[model samples]
Target: MPTITIKNIPEELYEALKSTAENHHRSINSEVIIRLEQALLPRLKTPKDKLTNIQRLRAQISPNVISADDIDDIINNGRA
Candidate 1:
């Protein structure tokens, strides 16, 4: 195993990292390693993963469906 030292980390960033590590029940070093891996290692998403992510994001949105008529009314009346 190799050891590394990081210097001059901003106070706010350190605090945020510390808070996140505590929330996840991880040590600061482990949190840094996890974060570094996430930033440096890119993984290809499978079709199912992509669909799941899209569905998850869509679920957060309001269910209001806008129609063409509604769009025309908004454009003409300058109202949402």
Candidate 2:
């Protein structure tokens, strides 16, 4: 196996990672490996597919004024 060394990591980020590892009952190395796997995993999506979906959704909604508060409420409540 090839050895990897990470350099110049911020102290605050290191502390956060150590805390997260402790919370999940995992070693720092294990936690970092899991995080790296998640970050590097390929997401399946074509640019055309994403644009088509966005356009279709936009067509369904009226081009009316929407408030920031309304958007926040929708996100927080996860409902209409």
Candidate 3:
């Protein structure tokens, strides 16, 4: 395996990476590898597949009850 050293990373970004690594109970190197793999992998989902997933997720949650007013409020806030 070849090792590489990256220099001149911004302090904020390095800190964020360190924080994320700590949150996941991984070393910075391991977390970086995992993130790189996720970024590189292809996730091919069709519109139908996405809809099916949404439906499945909704089904998994019991008694999904959000009022129309709540929906309207969310839309209004997003528009503002």
Candidate 4:
């Protein structure tokens, strides 16, 4: 196993990492390794796969419950 040292981590970031490690019952080093793996490795999804997921989620929503006007109003309200 290789050992490395990280220098000059921001106080807030270090605290956040420490808190997350404690919450998940892991040591800081383990938490860092898990986070690094997630950052470096990602799952590849095809366009068809993504579209299928979108369609599945959209199918769960009831039809005609909210009108287009309601959606527009919701969007405009957020801008004010």
Give the candidate number with the greatest lDDT: 4
Q: How much lDDT does candidate 1 score?
A: 0.95
lDDT of each: 0.95, 0.92, 0.92, 0.97
Q: Is candidate 3 or candidate 4 better by TM-score?
A: 3
TM-score of 2: 0.51
Measured over all alpha carbons after superposition, the RMSD of each candidate to the real structure, in angstroms, is 4.4, 9.9, 5.9, 5.2
User: What would the per-residue lDDT of candidate 1 be over residues 1-80, giving only the tens digit for each residue?
Assistant: 99999999999999999999999999999999999999999788999999999999999988758888988998989853
Predicted model with the maximum TM-score? 1
The residue ranges of model 1 lying beyond 4 angstroms of the native Cα positions read 52-80
lDDT of 2 by residue, 2-79 (tens): 779999999999999999999999999999998998899856789998999999999998875788898898898986
Candidates, ranked, TM-score: 1, 3, 4, 2
lDDT score, residue 64, model 3?
A: 39
Clashing pairs in 4: none
lDDT of 4 at 53: 100
Q: Judging by TM-score, tell me the better candidate of 1 and 2.
A: 1
Give me the runs in candidate 2 sitting further than 4 Å from their true place: 42-80
| lDDT for model 4 | 0.97
Tens digit per residue, CA lDDT, model 3, 1-80: 97878899999999999999999999999988888888998678999999999999988887738888989999999999
